[model samples]
Target: MSYDLLFTGGRVLDPGSGRDAVLDVAVSGGRIAAVAAGLPREAAREVVDVAGRLVTPGLVDLHTHVHPGATYWGIEPDPVAWCSGVTTWVDAGSAGAYALPALRRAIGGYQVRVPVLLNISAVGLTGRTGESRDLAHCDTDLAVATVAAHRDLVVGIKARIDAETVGPHGLEPLRRALAVARACELPLMVHIGAAPPTVGELLPLLRAGDVVTHCASGIALGRGGLDPALRRAYDAGVLFDLGHGSGGFAFDVLEAQLAAGMPPHTVSTDLHGRSLHGPVFDLPTTMAKLLAAGLTLAQVVAAATVAPARALALAAGTGTLAEGVPADLAVFAVEPGPFPVADVHGRRRTAPLRLRNEATYLAGRLLPPRLPAPPPPWIPLTAAQRTALAARDRRIRDLLTTPLVTPDDLADQFPRPPDR
Candidate 1:
């Protein structure tokens, strides 16, 4: 059978399949047809030459907030996905039982796949914080029923356990979230921040396959070192995710984890409205932070792809380029770098390599590039960032305002009558 599209001469680095070689990837019927060393160019309808580019499964960002215009943290993933090569954008707890339907409706409008980690709080981040301050919002029965109703969309459960979010409730909110996760038999992804219920109390409650996002949080980790309890959780198979939101990741804390031989199981941008512009720009930038932290390129790729897919037990072939999988693919230019990358605090690190997206495709259809909307009024920005944004707006205005061509460049259609 003839293939629909072929990507020739790319370094097909599919960590899920353990295949990393200069090869060709063919797609047909919106599914991967083959991944072989060579294929007849004549058999495919269109062949894209991707020489010297790195090709892999479209990235799966395990933690993000994509229910825009509804949740305060939400940002539209499409504008970011096309340019970043992230096809699976997991909306981590932007909606809870009360708000799940709205989140579900929001995702339908997107081109890329968006699986949700249903928020434990019924309010679901509609505001900036306090999603779980009231235990009533953390109703296990409601959350379980919501999961049962939308198993197709809900991948896991999410709870942000922190001082501001939980208030005086402490670990009660988390206990309720765990109850929902247990009832559904789905993994739980908990976001950790400041105290009332510290990581010490929080880590022991989580079971295997459950994710602890913001694993390197300085505020949560206290003294900025690997606590024994955190180590125990890691040993007991609790997965760590670098949920690099506005205040989540800290360089020193991550460095300590690395020193202790504990690496994050997955790297994610937690790319909400607050973190979208600065600190956490996209998944690739977040991945580069791990590169700066000393994880090998292959290791980072696995954490971003197969590990997260397995962490959530996502659909079959979700992170693999195996034949019959939906042809979700990405192509990137491996830019060598002494590139400067920063963490939430003003700390900096130089990365050795950076992957920049050239193209992203989902179900064998190329994602169109889309410009991002201006930052919302409440999103905090540095003065320089504000100035840069204004300058960019001016540039776009200037380009569009200018005439397309001079009068002399145009040809007359009715030259015989000297058309006006």
Candidate 2:
């Protein structure tokens, strides 16, 4: 049988099957037909020679906010997905029951695959602090109903257990969220930040499949390096996700965690409007950070592809490039140079190399990055849309007005850890 397309002379890496070799992969009718070292280029309608690049299963980002024109922090998924080698991205609590209709309407006709983690609060990340400030919004019944109604879209639940988001109520909202996750029999992606309940307190509640996002934030809430509770949770099968947002990732924290034998199970860029320009650029960047820290390139690729797929409980073939699977793949160029990497806290590190997405293929269709053009207007500008956009713009303006943080500002804003 003739193939539709063929990728030739590239190092093929499939973390799921531990298959790493220089091979030619063939695709037919949107599924991978064969993977071998030599397949006649004449057999395919198109043959792309990718000699110096690496070919792997399309990257799957387990955390992101892509409810474009809907959520305050949302960015369009396709552009980010295509430009960064991410074929699948999970919307990490950009919408809840009350706002999910708009998210569903906005994401229609997109080329990429986006699974969603329904927010526990009725009104998701609408405001700056996020959705759980008002205890009344943590309605398990409403979340359960929404999950049941949109079972195909809703894969899990998200609850931000941050000091400002949860406030005085502390772990009550989390309890409600846990109840909702249990009721739906879906996993929970809990965003842990500055604590009123603390990371230690939160770990006891998470079971095997539940995910702890932003585990590398260097906030002063959880006491000591690598909290014992977190270690115990890791041992108990709780998954750790690198939710590298504007304030989530810290190299110091990541190093400590890695030394503790708890490297992130899934690498995800908590990609949102505020972080798109800076430290948390994309999923590929996050994976590169891990590679620089210690993980082999293969291990980092596994975290981005198979590990995330398993965390989300996707079907068997979802994150593999084995024959008969969907032909979703990413081609990347590993450039050697002094690539500077930064964490959220202005801490810097230099990675000897960086991974750049050369091209992405979703079901055998190649997608390239859009050339620089004027920013497009957000579509379907309803009242809700305008409110969120205006708020975001105001924050952006404030960020611009605040002169670039000088040495004094950095010293004042991010205090050094007290002398032990």
Predicted structure with the largest lDDT when compared to the true one: 1
| TM-score, every prediction | 0.96, 0.87
- Each prediction's RMSD over C-alphas, in Å, is 2.4, 14.3
Local distance difference test values of all predictions, in order: 0.92, 0.85
lDDT, candidate 1, 72-178, per-residue tens: 98899999999999999999999988888888888899998999999999999999999888888888999999999999999999999999999999999899999
lDDT of 2 by residue, 1-420 (tens): 799999999999898977899999999999999999999999999999998899999999899988755566787778677778898878999999999888877767677888899999989987667478788899888899999999988889999998889888889989999999999999999998886788889889999999999888887323244888889999999999989988888888899889888898989999887677566868888887887788888899999899999998876577789899889999999898577788888788877678898999999998765421112353233465457657767887798798897777665667889999
RMSD of 2: 14.3
Cα deviation in Å at residue 252, candidate 1? 1.1
Judge candidate 2 at residue 275 and give its lDDT: 74
Clashing pairs in 2: none
